[model samples]
Target chain A: MSGGLTLVVALPLLAALILILLSRLERRKGAIAGPGFFQRNGVAVGLYLAVAVGFWAFFIIVLPQLAMVDLSFRPKLPPSQMGGPKDIFTLENYRYFLFGSTTSTANWNWLHIKAFFLSIGVSILITLLNLAICYPLAFHMAQSAPVARLRVLLLLLIIPYWVNEILRAFAFRVLLSSGGVVNKLLMGGGLLDAPIDFLGNDVGLYMGLSYAYLLMMIFPLYNAIESLDRNQIEAARDLGAPWWHIHAFVVMPHAKPGIASGCTLVFMLSAGALAAPLVLGGPRTLWFTPIVYDRFYQAFNWPQGAAYALILLFACIVFVLAVLRMFRLSLGEIAR
Target chain B: MAAAVELEGVNVTFGDFVAVRDANLTIEPGEFFSFLGPSGCGKTTLLRTISAFIEPTRGTVRIGGRDMKGIGPNKRPTALIFQNLALFPMMTVAENIGYGLRVRGVPRHERDEKVKNLLIQIALPEHGHKLVSELSGGQRQRVAIARALAVEPSVLLLDEPLSALDLKLRQHMRAELRAIQKRVGITFIYITHDQGEALTMSDRIAVMNAGVIEQVGNGRSVYAEPRTPFVASFVGENNAIRGRITQAANGTATLDTPIGPLTGRNPVGLPAGDEALIFVRPEALKLGGDPPSGFEGEALDVTYEGSITHVTMRVRTGQKITLSLGGGAAGILPQPGDMLKVGFEPQDGLLLARPERS
Candidate 1:
């Protein structure tokens, strides 16, 4: 309902409309080699653009987003009590998220804010951890291994990812539990006097999330690193560069787009993940998705849930944009 | 400060496959040495062993009289310009050239100064700020060479670095590379499958085949007096005549071939009744010759190639022999299907024992 939000949604639509009008005008003016896919493939590209804009944009993205925005700006009411004169569109849900509920009497609620920041911070940490864990493995799989061994390694990496994420997280849950294998092994080795509380805190959740998206982080890196000419590395070595320098100056810069892509994907997914947190996190661990879950299911507050979900989506978008900027890459480059 | 390279009985094998077998070579300092062969001839493998990229399976490699048994490529007094050039596309031309200096902890000011001087050396002085991807293929090649030379290695190993360039640029670079090597006065070991490049650029050429070095000599010697059948067949085009030695006398063999009796210098000196092959350059055979011996055949085809006319003839026994005559020999030009007499001086023909069929 705000002018800013309206403009944010309308800017892309306006650009698309301008492009379509210009293309039509150019078509009427006569055939010319202008910069448009429509000019190249003729009516087929126009038909493709029409289908994409008409069906996918409307049904998948724009319509659902509009519905969410509408829901977020409305009053929450039961079905029997809905559509009454008293039930009016309001900013109560957004206000309730920013401040506290009416009974709290606080100027601004810190719990939701703290939870959002904590989730974002930890998601970033998990993304970084995944990058560290997957980079060397990806490099080894892509370059160091023989072709036959590389196939076996790729199969091992891919096969684990084929298991559902939730099941994988539960498996982590079992391993990270107090009486789990990790703790037993540690205790048996006399490294610890007592069982560590991995799941009781968010440690288990972080590990589970990083492990759950390990393949997503590895594949993009593998594809990028694989394209690097092995001769470059050997040339660097022959030029008297140490191994670390070779990676720092040659390999890492080459894999930047993949790193950005993997980080963005892992950050977005982990930030919005619900199951890992629910399964592996303790009651005190207040991840933002659990709050959204609480609002929609437990408190039966659809508007508040929509508000939280939209805010999380916006945060993820900002993160992706920031990462793209930091890596000096476009979405197109990352997609490659 | 150039260094000589010595490979003493070096053998490199990977699993069950022998890449280089019993190689012994000594490359004098400041000499342009080239390994000439077809692909999979182990020329590149031999070069890598000298550069210490791969350790020899059996013997030792020495550079400037220092044993190179345990030295890696980084510590060796040599740098390799890869076959692909391998210019770091992410770096600017100056950065790519300065990388060797930078890694050695050289100060930025010194590195930049050296890089600027190297840009001039490669004749791309204005393109230092440009990325490697922006340069033409030949320019990238120069940058790669300059980058390797920046480290001041006493020996430079080049692995077919000119293979990617177009023909004209490749020929042009052959002169430029030789000039640079001479200016630097470093031992240059070049690898290439193209014999033209090897012959034109190298001070000495080692002809290799099937993991074995068949012969090592100057370009003229290798071409004029090849010791092995493979070298004679590989180094240049030759007209091969198979025969059995009927008489051996004073380093000359008289062979009874399908084309008729022929006498030539016999290096292998197979005894009487032994199978042999005599090879003669196309230019050595001439039309309407009558001394020692000659072959009478029907002229099958005549191809005029600028300064010379190549004539293909089939003798009565049904073997093809090709001869090149001077283009100005218009009066002597034989038309196709006409009977022609072609003969060569006994000294121009080289006779060797027949190579066993694989």
Candidate 2:
């Protein structure tokens, strides 16, 4: 291995060793007025172990491509018949991904900007649709209906989500297909001269993707609207303010926190989504996810996929961090 | 020419259940009227019907002699302070108080000036810019009144606005609320399940039960002379002596009860040969040596509550009666199971024509 690779593995180990030594030294110093010296040392050691655990968790779970290939396959070249020794520090595949070498010209180095921008648009659209659809329904339903009826409506919305995501996408595929009932009805009504192109196109991809992620957006918004105090609305009316004023002043402001949290959750989920795009998206509707898939499955490019995957993960982390900073929140505050 | 607020045969129904039955009531201008009852007794529904949140199913609400049909809450010159006070926690005190004016397209300077006056009127002068959450319970209560008053409504409706406060704060607010009502000189229709708040604050009290108005009168009249069993039992602590009427004449009645023949003041609509329960307040029943002049009973139990001692005892034929004795009385404080003489004059017990079954 190259010296840089060797040091990449050694630095964290050195830090762990130092932490263990410091913990032992602190234990020998005895207790203090605050926490027990052993307890404080244990806490410091625990923080170090957490960092170690977190690094490996990313190494093993998040970046599974390089982790899998490193443990099983030959690193540098094609194996001899049964199995053979392979060189460790070869830069051949990385060159293939980045430069598109003649040996493997199909490799696409992951750019990630296209997918990142697409996800942002998709998250915004989903948030708007959820707010529009749920605001009126939840507000009217909260006061007028009995609690039992409200529960039933909520349960019905949740039940459709219990079906496997693949099944749901397949169902949408059937709806968007040319010979399907949706297109047939429209064609029969003279709305279209012929069945429209849907599945295997961007239209079908948008339809399927929205259907998959809408539930995540709707649930948080509905909960927020339901928790709003009903009497405040009545007070606004009694105060002689019109309907719009009442909503703008009292109802909307009270539910603002809920809207913030719901938007954050829906935005993250829509951005990271893989299954809907992989299945429903046509060749024309290229997103960042399928790029990661092709690099891993078809090109036999493990290192490049790892780099690409880490890029996507880092983008998501940054996006969440930015939202938290703007709203003065932490992941701890946003937990369900 | 007419009363300030009038409900002519108002009835409110919720699906299959009738929350308020045909109820007739009228309040003159500048009157502090209260709808008082236990919870789910339809006092709140009546308030909402008047406020136009819930339209009356079978009656017309007339405010200042105008039929309130096709009039929504926003069109009406009325304001209701909700049971929770419903103060906007997101807004500051001055902003909340100025909301009505702000909604009315009043200019910024004028609205601010009006809010300043209202803050001073509520005695929360320095708290004009504080958030609603930062204010104390008593301060919030006054802020609610100020907000309602800022609208300059013909009638102000308050629905248990003091219920959220502590006991001491609630008492202080009771006085403050009445003072505000008087100072504003606007008709106030208050809804509360608390009889104490109603009796203490209202110029006239409307006692309601099971969607029906049991009685409506001045506080002292309602307290001293309750018209029905529900009103007597609800208004104050009373000893209901169950009996069968033997005879009735000249606003006085003779009844044969478990305590032998009992003579008591008569209630209207009670004819002879009817079963009625007599309501005598605990304070009105006297317990001492020889029962003053013409009555007798034995002291069964004595419960001292600081200033007044509550003595429970049995009359001649094993009927228990509770009487309140002042603490400073120059006599021995009675205890449980002590036989003593007790007397309540015929005027004290208000005979009910139809005594409550329970």
The candidate 1 chain B region of ten consecutive residues with least summed lDDT is B1-10
Which one wins on lDDT?
Answer: 1
Cα lDDT of model 1 by residue, A65-152, tens digit: 9989989988888888777875788988888878979899778888998999999999999999999999999999889999999989
Give the native contact fraction of candidate 1: 0.83
Q: Going through the candidates in order, what is chain B's TM-score?
A: 0.96, 0.94
DockQ of 1: 0.79
lDDT of 1: 0.89
Model 1 bad stretches (over 4 Å): A1-49, A77-91, A102-105, A188-191, B1-3
Which candidate leads in DockQ? 1
Q: What fraction of correct interface contacts does each candidate retain? A: 0.83, 0.83
Provide DockQ values for all models, in the order shown: 0.79, 0.66
Pick the TM-score winner.
Answer: 1
